[model samples]
Target chain A: MLFSLDPRISRLELPESAPAPPDKAALDQFPTYEVFHQRKENTAYVYVGPVHAPEADVAFLFGKEQFSRRFPCTGMWVVPTEAIRVTEYGDDQQSVYDRLPLLPADVLAATDAAVTEAYDIFHLKKRGKAHTHVGQVQATSPEAALQAAKAAFGDQRPVVNVWVIRSTDLLRSDEADRDMWTTTPDKKYREAIAYKVQDRIDRFKQEG
Target chain B: MYGSASTHDIPTQATTGLENEDPILLAEFEARIARGEKIEPTDWMPQLYRKQLTRMIEQHAHSEIIGSLPEGTWITRAPGFRRKMAQMAKVQDEVGHAQLLYSAAETLGKTREQMLSDLINGKSKYSNVFNYPTPTWADSNVISWLIDAGAIVNQMANAKGSYGPYCRALDRICAEEAFHLKYGHDAVVHMATGTPIQRKMMQEALNRWWPAIMTFFGPSDKMSTHTEILMRWKVKMATNDACRQQFLDMYVPKILEIGLTLPDANLRKNEDGVWEFSEPDWEDFKRVINGDGPCNAERIAVRRAAEENGAWVRRAMQQPKAQYVRPLA
Candidate 1:
């Protein structure tokens, strides 16, 4: 095994300032990808991995490095940065009024129907979570899609809002890639038995 | 990965598409998290989930980035070859860990560069522990021992967290922490039984770190934290006080056995099989987390310098390939 660093602290930045940018801003734009993990068919999709690639395919390598390094998983999904439909939030209206409750119930109901142009996406969460996308799907129209999500999901619990996106637009990793999931300790350094070298150091101390 | 926040306007939930009383949609989403399940990216979820997840993940992402300063300092000053090596590996793991976490956070819909900018500008915050300085070389051992110990305890429980990626990262981090704990303990034991100077170093380091270590878990969230909403939703797996207590129960004895006295005079084990210590100044915890700690400014400055310095590396990666530059074309 090799010598290990203390796991207590992190090192993305340095002491005086940051060490430097880890990758190119634009390079990241093209090469870095956002990872999505599906724990099970029943569970709502969540962001669970990271992959890097200059193109969509390259994302698989980095995504494997990021998501499957050591953690066990049922499935992994990696998509290019451009493939995502992201809307920025917290604008002037937030400061203008009504911070909490998100929206008036009536507004919630009306917008739900009004925005039904087609292909709406919904991100749902019971509690707020990191890697939250709530489950997203494309439908013919936003309202109908929202309706479908509600029928498929439910509206009793707090289902936030629906974001409409065309399914065809979303870039998803091949769900059938069994090979990526099976290649184990061979490729990942951390998974190697040698990674336990520090534990050996601990055992050495305990022996003394 | 930075966002175009300047042009982005916040839209109410209505605009995002919650048109009618979709009772069915709500149920499925609730059923998912309620069954000890993780919500995935393609499932039907409400918009608020994405918004809230974005906020929390961004802060956590920033934490991983800002968290580096205190310990990275000691990488150069670690005692012997073993310590130095251990320190190096640990820091690298942290970088990897941050990458995992930021990637997870981005799923909530913000880019990594955007999160970094927030950290540099002081708009985002990390764990209060990072806001303080590691004043001595021994401080590195203490950080690995205590701070990491506290984090492990929190993350262990968090491995069961509702969100998939955060939980996965926690699982991976927890796996690595076993070695980390041993490294810190090894340091403590090595120092305690080593030279007289080494023992003194350990004590001083503990004295400075003990309170902050206790504060590692945010102050008792009894009065706030919306734990009910969060827990039912799966944002956190346990309560702050409970996790803090668990950390004390597990580590206090270990620290003492390592031949180090905790800084508290009143620190003692209780009749109920719990180790009890004086409450850390909750106010101080707030102050530290709020960016008023001893080393908060210094930590931020270091992060900014590193980010700025590293800009070209990022630029180089993005520069058009020289292979494509034809002669006089």
Candidate 2:
């Protein structure tokens, strides 16, 4: 029998040896969602990381817990990984917009819609840096959005990469619920600065 | 909090199959690393680099997940309300760290499903120190303070590594680990300074954990072409001996200052400022790591049970027609 010092494990009465279960099937952990967060008011949303979930709502919840639980976040955003169109990464000193193949005016106009759809543009300032929200562009499609982003922020140099996602695809935290970010004073124990260990050690040495 | 500097699966031989790589592409990759450019997921990379990194990151992720079990067992019986709450938070942080690390490993082309499967099947190895059990509250405290301290030493070096996703994940993991170290130190200090019974318990726990802590960095590495290439590529950031010495330099004084004794009588700083201690039994370390440790069966059985029990919920939550895509950093 498998024995453990912890009573909970002991109670489980697990067998000493068991056959390895079958390998998990694909998509067992769900698809990926790219997560971003705003550290404070008026700050640009920065890419924190990614989460796996079934849909947008669960993704937002997981994103909040994963990214915001430890750090102070004023706002957060989660988008499906498939929804974001990424550009080829440029060198550290170069802007990725310069590498964009120009779409002819006729071709751009052909895909133009009466009501422009809003898309969010994020930029990587340098290699290895997280992408940050640059601005929004109105375009009929993701390709047009890239063209519009070039017009809006192409002058900003040193963009190593860019990610464009439809604004409608984002599940962002509501500005109205600002109180959720406020951690309780009692939670100070969780901070590194909470422990006054040196004082006690000093007392022990003095006694010795 | 439990990342070890040593990865068990790294090939120790001089043959790395470098000649098979296209000379031009290999030169560009090496030059980029030399220039301190971080390699993103989509970048062209040598197969050895990818395999080594995936193994390292996956093992680190598994450590976080399994490492939580011993500590999580303490949340119920922690000394008081405040300690209990802190314990719970620390355990939760470890599990969350696993999530972050699993996602980082995924960016390297391995699916999280396959990684978890390998973990339960015992094909992948985590930090070997976790194979031993935490038999007392004081034993748990040793893990919190010293094991976390050791992890920080290893992780701080890796945070500067070349893989962008792994580096980013390490950045976040290190920030949270600061709290764990302090919290552990606080707990250990409180017990050591308490009544005689408490002090004795604390001392006993330290004695029990010192051997495992010595082996925490694994054996002294024999330099090979594989090791040299990994270091140049920024895959293996520091030698295992370097990390172990650094941990001793930072922590030994702290343990002594608290009036506790390390089990090794010969453990002292030498003339050249090196720590000299009894060589941990490599035989025992190998036996434990290879599935003959005191608690190896229990750890795996528990992990397998968790996966088997949770399969139904995972299936229920999986969306129909869902497609798998590797995470983008």
Candidate 3:
């Protein structure tokens, strides 16, 4: 066993007898709704976490108390968790965008025509950081997506603005052309590999 | 802010067989660590590294949750509205830390359910300080200021560790804990400099908590295996004695400055710059950690009751046919 057990105490047990199990009907777990927060007018909306509430209004209330009570937050949005679509990137599988090609104009038009409704798409950009993909909500109209997007990703972090677009509006790159996206040879532009300007300035001063 | 050292019996040098691992892969991993690169969730790592990280992070997560219980009882009885609100938020942040830590540990393959089960079943240990009771509001204040000060010392070191998820979580948690430290200090100051009644209460609380605070970083590192390999891996950032000395150096002056007296009469720093204090009773620590303390039964009972009561909520949240999926960091 990885954990150590005390031999002196043969067994440690709960002191009180267990209470009777709860009835199923007594379990009133509310639906989980994802919350978004907008810190100010110009910033992006951010996903905070999920709140359990029966309706969007109550969720917003819960989100306010849970997240923004001590923190500065201007606006909040709450949407049912089930309404959000998540596309998680995996190491074993190539990212969906990397494998799929952009739809042709005619195919895109046909698909757009088939579904007049558009959904919002949110993508998480990286691990261990927030504000990548605040996530999206499916709605019948652009106005609804705009409204729903605010509630879902709003108050968890400092988000000033939110992105609202039709799901069909998303474009993908061809799998064979993946190198175009993957290749980056401009080491000078990246701070990690770029030589220190301050060091060079100090060296020149010493030479002078 | 929850990586307090455990009072349990220290394990022997556990990383002995890593010499037989693929030397090239080990070298690459070490090089990455040397370069200050974080080991991500999908990154290749030694089995022992994973096990140690998992155990450490799991214990930390447990500490956060169990740590909440002491101060959590004061939320309702907090003297006024401001104190009430601040107390609630501070306790909530502790629970939030637990949630973040559990998720971070989950990345190492142990499920949150298993960790919580271990916690309730006494198969795992939390920070030994939590097993002590908070008898009065002043005790909570002492914990908020001193215990959290010790945690910051431990966590700030571990925050620079090689694991990506735990480091990130610690970053956010430490930010919140900074606020808690301020909140706790404000309360303690008010009591220390307040009327005689308040001062006495604060002093009594301080005297009671000082011993446990001394033992918070675990026993003297000189007496243990010293976790040398864990240090090399950046998993255990500082030794127990180092953390303890740092805590005393930082907080001892502040404690005395606040007109509070610690229980130890001989606690002082020597000319050699090492903290010299009467050693805390290691036998008492062992006995308490083995489940004989004043509040151990109460703490575990409360946690067990919480788990039992919350089972319905967990069951309700579960989807009938949904498969378990590991969370992405």
Q: Compare the candidates by DockQ and give the number of the best one.
A: 2
Judged by DockQ cut-offs, the docking class of candidate 1 is incorrect
TM-scores for every predicted model: 0.63, 0.98, 0.70
Per candidate, native contacts kept equal 0.07, 0.81, 0.04
DockQ class, candidate 2: high
Q: TM-scores of the first chain across all predictions?
A: 0.49, 0.95, 0.48
Q: Give stretches of model 3 more than 4 Å off.
A: A1-40, A44-70, A73-208, B6-10, B222-226
Candidate 3 versus truth, CA RMSD in Å, comes to 13.9
lDDT per residue as tens, model 3, B84-160: 87787788888877867877787787766677777877778888888887879999999988899899999999988
TM-score of chain A of 1: 0.49
| Lowest lDDT block of 10, candidate 1 chain A | A89-98
User: Of the candidates numbered 1 and 3, which has the greater DockQ value?
Assistant: 1
Best by lDDT: 2
Q: Model 3, residue B31: displacement in angstroms?
A: 1.8
Runs off by more than 4 Å, candidate 2: A111-115, A184-186
Per-residue lDDT of A55-155 in model 1, one digit per residue for the tens?
55556666666556555555655554444443322221121112222434565566555633334243433323333444544344433455455555453
* Cα-based lDDT at residue B21, candidate 1: 28
